[model samples]
Target chain A: MIINARYIAFWGCTIPALQPYVEKAARLVFGELGITLAEPEGMTCCPDPDITHMASHEYWLITAARNLALAERRGLDLMTPCNGCFFTFTEAISELKRNGKKANAVLSENFNMTFKGKVRVYHALEVLYDVVGPENIKAKFTRSLNGLRVTIHPGCKLLKYEEKRLDVKLYELTKLTGSTILTYGLERLCCGVPLMYLDADKAIELRTKPKLDRMKEVNPDAIVVICPACHNQLEKGQLMISEDEEYDIPVISLLELLALCMGFSPDDIGMYLHRIPADDALEKLGLI
Target chain B: MNEIHPLRKRFRSLPSSFKGLLRSELRIGHIYELTDLTVSDREDLGLPSKPPTAYSDPNALEALKRIAKATNLKKDTGFDVDKLDFEW
Candidate 1:
């Protein structure tokens, strides 16, 4: 696979701060695919659509524009692993196109930077499924997760973009691993990471519990997720409710799974960093 | 989220998400900061102790700070970026 696509790797706040394991796996997997991930120099948070936008939409717009400008200067599109960052950057680009005149003025006056709207944003899921192609991915895998059963959790933000519905992309990419994706009725449901800000208990009972319960019935080996926020909510939410029932389903990132099959050791990707141990799933992969 | 409804009236006080925003602004110029343990973990994984983002780059952090001040983010959020340090 001679994929010549190169983009600025947007390691959003969560990956570096809370989910370095995902970063480790992504570096390994993307490297193997012949994809070049250039790190953007002055990148900040996508400024967080949920939090920053709530406090002040104007600030959110400007901060996101600054990040976008960094990529535009480099003449490369920005690609992020976080669904929220993807949603934020995509929506920011659209909003800027409509009202970027004022933003460009502020950017020029403050930092002498202007987001000329030259850059495009991509989620790693789209890059893998569309650009790299699943056949190329399958060709690179040294072993297949033939009998591994896992349930998919496509986070909420990725679903809202109608043009490129990433849920289907996530499903198709997971299938390339040769794992049977257990059908769960609530794949589209939000993992309730956003709601945790308002009410933690209700976020668990109303959102996380129902999804976990549904997947529990299927008795899959793991719950696979792409978003760091979803990974945090699903994995940490289980430990929060551990006193009540044992929802021991380990949450694995799609990148980590691909890295495993590509012959990287589990330890190499920081599987031990998971709040809920993925020992059961790793053992199934013969990685333990 | 603010498009759905204004968050000012939605919650009586700052939510964790709001603190997260402040943390991004005032603490490390990102949503989460790196601890010693996490830094060591990155080293073990053959990655840089700190990534090349704003938190690691002094120039980037300066740019973020300048932008935050110019945009009145502290005023809009109704908290002083210098004070009210909760270690977020």
Candidate 2:
């Protein structure tokens, strides 16, 4: 199967900070698969978080519309990995498609630009799951992650955006590459990253603490995160909370795990960036 | 392309209150259906049956105390008092 190599690798604000490891792994794997990811110049912050909080409903529409316009101007479909960016782009595109004239008019007036209303935005997980087949990912695994237990936290944006509303199907994609997925009571709860900006204590209480407790019970070797925001929040939040508590499970990007299973070194995949060291797992795998 | 625009405009033009009603319906209309299973739901789903106990190591508490004190000092001093009070 031939996959098109024309899509833009859209990295919002968090990407530069959190995605070097995953991005490196992705390029290596995609190169092997004969797929090329293009990174366009002059792409700015998606402005989703800011617009959502500071702007009026109309202004939010224009802010997101401008991003879509920018991507469309590049003549490339936007492929975003950040859940917040994906939700904002997807929701903005959907809204504009639902109301193009008003949305385009507002965008034009605000940003001095017009959008053709013809770009498709995809979340990285969607690209990986649908475009890059799970069988292909399984085939890339030279090192089996046999005994290393993992828990997946599909942030609210990822699961909530799906049309069918099924949990098992949502989780099945993450469990595809022969790893034991730990199922815990608070599996579906938010990681509280979204609420961090609103109420830090409550968000921690409601989101991270519960997951930590649940993870301690299951004792997973690591936690797999899909969203960059969730990854940061889980890593920093876990470290902060662990200072008060005891368990210290490492948090990792899902792509990093895929790279590990494919026999990529910890340094090769940027595993050193993690707050909680994955050396214990690497030692167990004898890759250290 | 033209077909989608007008319908969306009309949809958005409805009274804000009417839109609120639609939003409410969208939020509450779904009644989730559950599948019948013989095993205990938690066991069948492999979900943890009980909440995990909290780990309270003394060293962790000391570290947390040090962090809290540092954070409090940072907050009180505003990280950079000169910058906070600066008039540029």
Candidate 3:
């Protein structure tokens, strides 16, 4: 199937450092699906860090409006895979839509430009869901993720704002690939990564650990993550917690994991970048 | 017993005074209480049961306020305080 859309593949800083593998895997999968992704010039941070830090609401809006303006200038829809970026961008759009005159006036004054409301923000997963279509995705699977239990972490941004718009449950995605999807009570929980910059220990103890505990009780083989923040927090947070108790489930990007079962190699999908190591999990599936 | 106000019921259910303050700080234009959220509920709401390491910072209250405002939950649904029991 061919889906044509020019997208600004906004990485928002974290992708290169902690999630290169995710970008690589996405490129491979999306390339095969015939979707084009490009990085627009003059793009800035999604204003998430500033907004979450409680910066002035006007300042946050100005910053995010600038990013949207950049995307609009290029006539491309902004597609972000990072949860924080998605939240920040989507929230900005929501706010502007709610207060159109004030939002546009701020843009006109600060950036000397008008926000014509031309850009549409989308998470990368939505693109994948659309192009791959669950049924076709199932057909692409070379190996079944059958018998392997997994917990899907939807992350805060994926579910909090307009959750119905994004396919967070991913039941269709998993079922299409011949895997059994098990969602625990914490399935919709935040991984507490945002609090990491503030309180590593507490974010771990309360936000991260509980989800791990829930997942452990179910004894899932791995935790599948959609947001990079959740992926980093859950994976590294578990490793830190593992020092006190044996925590062994591999944390994987949903894209990389799906690529593996679809017969792609670690090299093909850039699995080498993972800090928690997918080798054991790979060996289990005999992909190594 | 009389039917309790959603706000008062939520306030009584919190495990700590600090959480009550957090609930209060976040309440703003809406009403919120501890009973409206369990630990899992808090997680779902993107508010953690255990304060993040940054919880000690004086800025946390402000951050939470920003989050609340950005999400536009200040007027609708109030905080569902009864969900905090952690039974789930």
TM-score of each: 0.94, 0.71, 0.71
Off by over 4 Å in 2: A49-55, A106-112, A164-170, B1-88
**For residues A8-31, what per-residue lDDT tens digits would candidate 1 score against the true structure?**
989887888788899999999999
Report the candidate with higher lDDT, 1 versus 2. Answer: 1
Top-lDDT structure, candidate number: 1
Ranking by DockQ: 1, 3, 2
Chain A TM-score for each of the predictions: 0.98, 0.90, 0.89
Sequence-dependent TM-score of model 2: 0.71
Clash count per candidate = 0, 0, 15
Candidate 2 per-residue C-alpha lDDT over B2-67 given as tens digits, one digit per residue, 9 for 90 to 100: 675755542223333322322221122111111232113322223222111101123322222232
TM-score of 3: 0.71
Q: What digit string (tens of lDDT, one per residue) describes model 2 on residues A139-215?
A: 76787777778887877777776573323433655576556898887877888875665567888888888888888
**Sorted by lDDT, highest first, which candidate order results?**
1, 3, 2
User: Residue A189 in candidate 1 has what lDDT?
Assistant: 86
lDDT of 3 by residue, A1-288 (tens): 456767887766455435666766766666666678775455544555422225245545655676787688778898877777888887788887777676566556545666677899887777768645766665666778666667778777777756455644355665555556676788776788666655679889889999899888887777887777778778888789887977777777777766766777876765655677777767766667
RMSD of 1: 3.2
Cα error of candidate 2 at position A266, Å? 1.3
Question: Candidate 3's residue-wise lDDT over B4-76, tens digit each?
Answer: 6544433222233323323443432111222432333334323334222122233433433443344433233
